[model samples]
Each structure stands twice: as C-alpha cells, then as structure tokens.
Target: MKFFCATFAMVVTSATQAEVFTYECDTPPLSVWEVAGEWCSPLESLKNGLLIHQVDLCPGWPPPGGQFVFYTRSLADFDGAATFFVQWELQTNGDSSEFVGVCPASLSLGSFGPVFYQIVIARDTAKFHRDDGLPNIYISIAPDVPHTYRLELFGADLYTWYIDGMVVASGVPEGAYPSFYPAMNFGTRAWRLPNTTRWNYIRYGTIPLDAAGDYDSDGSVDEFDLSFFVECLLGEGVPSGPGCGFADFDADGDTDCDDWVAFQAHWTGPPAVPPIPPPCAVVGDTNCDGAVNVLDINAFVMALSDPSAYAIQFPNCPMSTADANGDGAIDILDINAFVALLQ
Candidate 1:
C-alpha cells in the first residue's frame, strides 16, 4: 500500500528547550486502532496535556510504517517498563492472519507461534530479529526519559532505528512480510499495575537523518557544503529539492541564516571531535587569516569579476565565502558589506 508523504508541525517544549518537528499521519483511516483488552484506554488526552495510551492490560494493534516519530515515556514507576513495538503481519488467504513482533525484548522469535521478524525496544535495551540464522542482537540505552524515537524503512528491506539522534540498530528483515504495524504493551514479561505510556506526538514521514549542513554526506561541514547551501539558497543551482533538507540545521523546517549559525558550529571538524569555534565569525573571511580584511576584499572582487578565472587562480578558496551579507548571493553589495566590516 502506498503511504502519503508526511506533513510536519513545529513544536517547542519549554521544559527541554528543544525544537521538534512532528509529522502528522495523513493516511486514510483503516479503523480506529484496535485495543488489545479492557484495561487499555483508547487514545485520549490527560490533564498534563499529553496524549496517552494506558497499556495496563492489553497489547494494542501496531500501526504501519511511513516517515514518522513518537515521543514516549512511561507515566508510572511500575515493576517493569512499558513497551512499544512494531510488527510484521503475514497474509493468510489474502488476509493478515498471524503477527510477528519485530524488536522483541523478552520474547523469542516464533516462540509464541508465528514465524516472523521483529525489533523490540524496552526501557534499558533493544533487540533485533531477522531470521533463525542470526542470534538476536541487543543495544542498551538509559531508560525512562523523554527521548525521541525514529524509525525509517528505506531501500528494498532496510529498516533503521534512531534514539535521540544516533542510530542504534538497522537491518533487513530476512523473510518478506506484506505489511507492518506499531503496538504498545505494558511491561516486558508480565502486565503491571495501571500505568501509562505518554506520547507527545507521533510524526509520520522520513526524518532528516543527514548531518546538518553536510549536504554532500561527507564527514564534515566545510567550504564545499557552504557553497552548495548558498547555491540552493539563491536558486542558482539545483532547485532546492528534498536533498537540500540536510541544510536545515536548526530543525525548524527551513534553510536560512539561523541554520547557518548552527552549521558554523561544525566547521571545526566532524561531530565526533568537534572543537567549538568563536562566535561572531565572519562568513566572508576567505583568506584563512583569522580576520576579514582588505585581502578578502580583493579576493571577493577577483571572484566576482570572472568566476572561472578566479577558480583557476585560487582553486583552494570557495566562492561562497565572499557572501558577506549572508543573503546567499555574491555581488557588488557583498563588496560594500565587506568594506563596511573593515571600517
């Protein structure tokens, strides 16, 4: 079944001081998601302004994959942590009959009956299931915090999971299942007291996983990326396509100077060993001399006069560095701006 592209909503959380984009599901309603048992509360709003699904008694039906995210945290200090899952359902006589939960934390594949693939995440650990040949692999994380969980199904069979911003696990399911869904159940081994699983929101769409401002997917955000970003910004190169989403460094759904500020933070190096650079650094400092001066002014003039000639003369300098006004365009106005900076 074809899934509709995602629509995003910008959200600000005062407590965490973080900006988030929530993808709202836009698919035609199949049915109000099935509740597993009586103890489970159908999706509803609570006094705390969070949408919750009380998984105290039953396992709810899992929803299918599209690009989306769900912010979840356990509401009660139960004996065991609450569990959320996605499963593959096998077709029987042209209709789904058996369910195999992927990402199973406490359950073994096919132990409960169906031959299946699954990935299970619990409070402290994550588990993966593909087939009988490979042993289930587990990755551990600190539990019970309001961390962002993201899942993306791409290529032929590749599925990847991300917690916060790091990829924790990814693999292709061994046997092909016609469809997938998300499920929620309280506890790993047994049902616990009346507890809640709070959801800030469930976004449906491909999350932008590329390194912010690293438009070329290279290891670092540097001069080359800056050039590409400026090209897109000025509409001079490839029309700002979906691929340009990587430049949205602030995650505010737009590529602008604000994002440029965040992108500059990574200019020192790759994410692993990022050394913070000073603030108020000028974008037009093309000479690499730690200051914007007359030398940069000359460089900008040469580049503006004849880009091809300038490229051959100073092959090391990126033409984008001369955009002193941050307007994503290089022209005489930038020359004037640079002179003003020198003044």
Candidate 2:
C-alpha cells in the first residue's frame, strides 16, 4: 500500500512535465538511433505498438560482439533531474544470463562513474539497478508481456522506479551520473544467448518535480507565471519556443485546457516582490558608469574583441548591452554602431 501511494505520487509528478523526446519505433528510427549486431528493423504492429526482433547472437569476440544494441546517435542529455519512460517486452527469456534491458550508459565498456539506472530481465526476473548498483532489486516479470517502466531521477541523490504504474522503489540514493543517453540491448556480451525484444515506445526529458507552473523559476506558482502560461496555451497543438514547458502541466506535448486546469491547481496567489537587481548597463557604456564616453572604449573593445575578458572585467554589466546595433547579438556587426555611438 505504501508502494502504491509512492507510485501514484511519482506518476502525478511526472505528468506535470513535458517529454523532450520520444521514439515511437513504428518506423525506422534511423534519424535518432544507431544499432549494432543483428538487430532487426522496427516493424509496425497493431497490438504491440512496434516490434524490434533481435536476431541470433553475433559469432565472435571483437567488433559487434554478441549483443544486439540500439542507442541514440546523439543526445542533448539532461542535467540535474531526468525522467525516462519506456514500454517494452522481452519475447523470449533465456536460461543463462541472456537478457534484454535498457539503461543510461555509454556503449563502450570502460566508461566510469555512476549510471542513473538500468531495468532488465536477466535471469528470468526483472531487475532494477540504481546509481551503479547501490543494490539490485529483483521482481517477478513474465516473458512476452509488455510493461511500462518509469524511472525518475531527482538531482544527484534521489530516484524512484515504477513498473506498470506500481512503485517498486522510491527515494533511492543516487550517486549522480552526470549525463546519460538511453540504450536498449538484447543478450549480454558475456553470455551471447539469443532473445527477441519488442519496444513499444520510449520517452525521456528533464522534468521539474516541484512548482509545476513556476515559469520564472522563482519557486512559486503566482502572477509572474501567468503570462508564460497564457503564451504557452496552444490548445491541442504542440507548444514551441522557450517557457512553453512552464505551462505543460500534463506533459502531453501540448499546453491545452487540461494543462490550464492543472496550472490553476498550483496557483499560490501573487508572488513575493523580489529584491531589485542591478540595472542593465547602457549600450556602448561597457564600464557601466552610467555614461557612454571615451573611457568606455577600452571596455567596449574588450567586449567586442575578448568577450570572456570583458565578462571578467565587467561582471555586473549585462551582456545584451554589448549589442550596440540592437540586433540582438554581440558580434562584429555591432562594432560599427558602437564606433558611431562613441563619435
């Protein structure tokens, strides 16, 4: 019962943040995926979603090795907090350590440091590995049946794992993996046994576990978040641009009425008045002494020629003020306008 309550809490938390990426596996995932060994192409299926049949194991020790591995070609990679959701099934479970699994680990063997988590069917049972085997938790999982798995990582030290909407683990200590790329594999490189796995879908992203509608990230849902919420309300369509995430309360790719409903639930009246920040420095006034003069020339040149140096020299000045032409960028194009401003 405690586990069920934890599971519900996790599900609710996850539903509040939008998924950054998803692979349905209904068609070729070539745009996002790279595969090794004899992994068959994804095929469309009505009941199964998409079926990826892992062919017989590889023959030798080098190169492709024994396992059939499919991993993303590239990843933006989440920082601080992340959530991974996958619906899949192992069609065959072998007697040996032959297994099918998904994890946030590099393809290479020697990469060190903690991995966020791993979910696998190794010896005819499902196992979850958190933060590089802090400990392994095993549970009974039947072969040839699809199950949804959710793993949520909070910062570097807390995580929760769920299987088919039930929490198997929660608040597990995490050692911080830094960043991760999702990977799915069938048969171990060590065991070399064959198995077929079907992946229905996979979705992952950075998610805020608290303050679901806090747009400015000031830690409360209040008046300041309303404008961002209104801007992100796209009804049934996908929300775009920055700050849309703040309004995606249902995490369904769209900021619709449902999201507005959720957003209202977190509303905490008007936000507290924040302390005044340093004023934005005038353009060409790189020294930020409240005047644009010849004395600003050296700093202006530094802002143009050596941005990093300028940043160190004028740590309090706004970088945007360096955009002398108001072109919204600090580049060689701004030099002419800055020189004219000096004259």
Candidate 3:
C-alpha cells in the first residue's frame, strides 16, 4: 500500500534535552503501548524479549491479516526541521517480513501520511519502503542472529542506517511532509505467515552520541570542546546553531549553567583521558583522600574558582562537597562555613 509521510532536517534548539525513550521487551510495558487489528495476539513478555507470534489461520482477512501494528504513546509533533534517532534490537525465529513505522500525532486510519518512515525486513534483507517513488536500497545482513538496527534522521530529507554498528545505507526521500509526533509501530507486512520475532529493546532520542560533550568525535572532552560549547550556549528554549548538540550535557534543551556544571565535570585538559568521577564520602572532603583537613584547602579553592581545573586535578574525587556552606552552591559565601569545618 502507498503510505504518505515526510522527513525532517535536524533543527538547532536549546530548549529541552532530547528525550531518551527505551523499552526492554523482556517485560513489555502494556500501559505505554497501543495495539491495533485482530488475529494478532498481544505480545507476551518473556525472558528473551517481547514475543510476537504470527499464526497461519488468518491468511486473507483485511485488518486482521493485512497488518497488525503495535505502537507507543504520542510525542510532540514537529515539521521537516526536527531531528531524531531510533534503534531496535531484534531477531526472528524463521523467515518473516516485519514492518517498522513512525508517524506523526494526527495520523488517521485512512490517511496515507500516517507512516513517516517505513522499514521492511524479510529474513536476512531489509529496505526502506516509502511512497515517494524512489527506488529502495536493500541491505543484506546476517540472518537468524540478533541485529542492531539504527536509523538517524538528520539534515534535510537525509537519513542513514546502521546494522551491527556498520553503516549500511544513506539516502534522501522526495515529497516529504510534516510529522505529528515521534511515535513508532511494529508488525507483520503483507500476507500473514507463520513466524515469530523477539524484540530485545528499542531506544530513540535527539542526540544519542557515544560520548557526551565531545562534539569533535574525539575520545576526550577538552578545551577544543569548550570553544564550540560557548557558541552553542544559547539559554533555554532559544535556537542554537549546527553542532550545538554536543554541549547540551543536561539535555535540558539549552547550553546554560546546568550544562556548564556537567561540562566542568567532564572537562579533561588537552587530549588526556578523563578519570572516572570519585565518590563523595565526607560532606567537606573535596580532596577525596578520606580526610577533611588542610590538605583539602587547595582543592576546595580550585573547586570554587575553576571547576574544570579542579576536575582534572582531583579526577578521582567529587567536587560537589565544596558546598560546605550547605547553600547548595560552591561560591565565596561558603568560605566561612568551609573554614569552620577545617578548624
């Protein structure tokens, strides 16, 4: 069937953190999922994942046999300028053609635009099925094994797919339209056949990069990142420019004070590796050597002046305890309270 839909280019915004939505199929949360059609039984949560069984009895029924889709609740709608990513981990028991779809919020049962992007998986091969008259690119993958499928919707009408961490395909679709929300659907495609699929998990977000605060794709977050981070620091809700996503540490949609704190925590000078943050044991032990004394004096000063430097110097210790004044902020106001602890 010809379905109507569109694609969006990633937009620059410092409004809200990209929402990270994840579902583990082992215990599917029915409250957050919606089901459509008959003959397809509700998915059962198993130790392996969520199981979908396709029976052979309903071979020619219209809604029942044609396609049985399970989808998530609604999300905010956006136009062609929005950006997002989705990943699914799954495996099939036998030969099967499964469909995965995403649609806007106002999708209608009869509207062709309901499914913005559709993927068709037949056993060891998969392809993008859109109504835009473009030829589909089929990617061959390892069959019967669990596969990690990722879809990235970036730039205008542009998309890239990764299977098992390898880039398999990239393309742009024509005649795109706006989307209502970021909702997803999964089900059987075409005639129902006897087969089963276990969905291990599904995750999607705005910027789900491997390393947070590392805009340059480098291994560490350093001064090189700070320069770019400054440019992206448009306060909450205001639009940022391209590549600003890296500085959005708190994912609160902006590169403000909150993100700066998180950035300071991750800062590693030059190309050095950042140390794993040490636990905070005592409320005033900024040095993290299991003591609260003069040895912590210099560490406390650095924590208040240049938090990023403090992080690099005391990589194994937490700086949060620098708030000795208990005012919840590490500033000069806490000096008096901090001295009392030292004495």
Candidate 4:
C-alpha cells in the first residue's frame, strides 16, 4: 500500500550516535560490488588518496534497506554538466519483475550553470512517470571541493536530506514501494568528457524507533519494555502512551500477534522480566525495600500460586522481578529459586 510522510520539518540535534560500517577504498574493489554500464571504470584513487569513479556513461551501484542513514560525498567537479544520482531502489526477482515494496525515489544533484548547483527529489510511479509534487532546492558551492551529503529514512515513510550537516529538504512521496537499496549513478543528458565522482564513505543501519522490542524508548530493549508491551497487549492502558509505537515492531500500526513474534526474535535477553535485583536486595522483593522478610515471601507465594490474585493484591509490582531463576516461565522452579536465594 502507498504511504506518505505526514509531516515535514528541518531538525538539527547533537544527540545519540549511530553505529555505522565504514568503507574507505584506497584501491579499486570493483569485484566486491555490482557495477553496471560500459563507460564505468573500476574504482580508482585520486592523487589525494580518495577513491573515485570516472565515467563517460551512466554507471550505477546499489545498497540496501527500508530505513537507514547514508553518507557520501563528491570529491571533485563534474567534467561537463553530468548529474550525480542516488536512488533508493527495490531488488527484482530473476525474471526482471519488481520485488515487493520497492519504490523509485531518487535524489539528483548537478550544476545547471557555472555558478548554480541544483538538487531534486524524484519519485517514479509504477507507470514510470515522475510524481509532479517533488521538491527541489538550489545552492552554490566552490568547484573541486568535497561536499558532504546525507539521506535518512525514518520509519517507513519519512525522507530527509542533508547537505554539509544542514537539512536541505524533507518530504513523503506518494506510492507503494518495498524496502529500498541505494543505487548510485553518474550520467549526463548528452555525452561529455568523463566526470569523476569520489565516494568518501557510506554508512547505513536501522533507525532506533525501527528497532525491535524497544517499546519503552529507554535506549535499550529489556524487561521493563516487555512488561509495558504486555500491558499494551492486554488493553490495560492507552495505546498512545509514550514510546508505545515501538510495540508495533512490524511497523504495521497495530500491536498484534505478528508484532509479538517479531519482538521475541529481537529481544536481547533471556525473556525474563523485571531485571535482577541489585546486591543486598532480596530476590522476591516486590516492593524493593531491600528485605527478604515475610512480606517479600508472601508476595512471591501469591504470584506463584495465583497470578490474577497476586496482581489484584499488588497491582504496581507486575511480578516481573519475581522470577529469581531468570527462566521465561513463572512456576514452581521460580518459587524454589527465590527460596534458595533467601538461604
């Protein structure tokens, strides 16, 4: 189904860092990548030790994901008026049929005149026509200087572009497309001298909100989030609670069985809840008062014998931390483990 970004805004923040994979090509590694078109030369290094692609025809390379961050650069000027293009593409089956969820959204940058540089976002429909509402921005930078570019896809819909650390444009395109792979191409409308484009690096990975089992947004996936997820599934609270959208692990807009299955795989722990108590704390200390006395034992017995009854008696505890053995199931095993902890 076609989905579009509901909001568009320029945001700048100095918060959180993403783990990225970096590729620096001091030498040509054409064999590791799929390079297409006859005019494309194998990757070569410039005098400055940066890797570049010098081509007289349209040359393309592809990179994959549904949501990710991509950073690349052009190390030199185009020999003629050729355009450098990067597109998010869907892979096709062996029969040349389009893969599911692939859309043809692309960013094009080039010099229209000696002093003018232009950038445009294009979304191609299934019928191979450009959507009329795409946005374009223009700016001027010195020739032969490296320029940085960044593209971010948030969730499954929002697209944001950046130039030199500043947001240049952002919007949602109309139409359905599968997860995308970055396809980088350099070509001109008319033949000209071979233009060389340097690629400094490309970094791509999952967006945090797109991470599985991170329902609580505490920057980590753990039992607290899982307990909250259970609450969400049971309809015990409002669905719009903070970070509740992370519970929709499948990004399908609803918390259901499918999300549960996805969450299980994404969970980083042993599927146990509340997290282990700290040293000097009792294993079954539901109230966290740091004692192993009668009250703690009573709460454990109640939870083990009758969960519903225990929940009614201690509504705030949730019994997640009560499982002393860290087993996923809460049963006699946990009861014994808790008792052994007291000794």
Which number leads on TM-score?
Answer: 3
What TM-score does candidate 2 reach? Answer: 0.45
lDDT of 4 by residue, 211-236 (tens): 36664334555554455456345231
Model 3: worst 10 consecutive residues (lDDT sum): 1-10
Candidates sorted on lDDT, descending: 3, 2, 1, 4
Which of candidates 1 and 2 reaches a greater lDDT? 2
Per-residue alpha-carbon lDDT of model 3 for 164-229, expressed as tens digits?
656777777443333544456655433434445556566555553432776544445665455446
lDDT of 2 by residue, 27-101 (tens): 554545565543333222323345454434445444223455445433323333344333332333443244333
Give the Å shift of residue 267 in candidate 4: 20
Give candidate 2 misplaced runs (Cα > 4 Å): 1-19, 36-48, 58-67, 81-96, 99-112, 122-124, 131-133, 177-192, 208-343
Instruction: Write the residue-wise lDDT of candidate 1 on 59-167 in tens digits.
Output: 5533331111122222111111111122211101100111122211222222222224444545555555556687866666665655455444443366556655457
**Candidate 1: C-alpha lDDT:** 0.42
lDDT of 2 at 218: 46
lDDT to native, each model:
0.42, 0.51, 0.55, 0.40
List where candidate 1 sits over 4 angstroms from the true fold: 1-44, 47-49, 55-119, 130-134, 175-194, 206-245, 248-343
Assess every candidate by TM-score.
0.35, 0.45, 0.50, 0.32
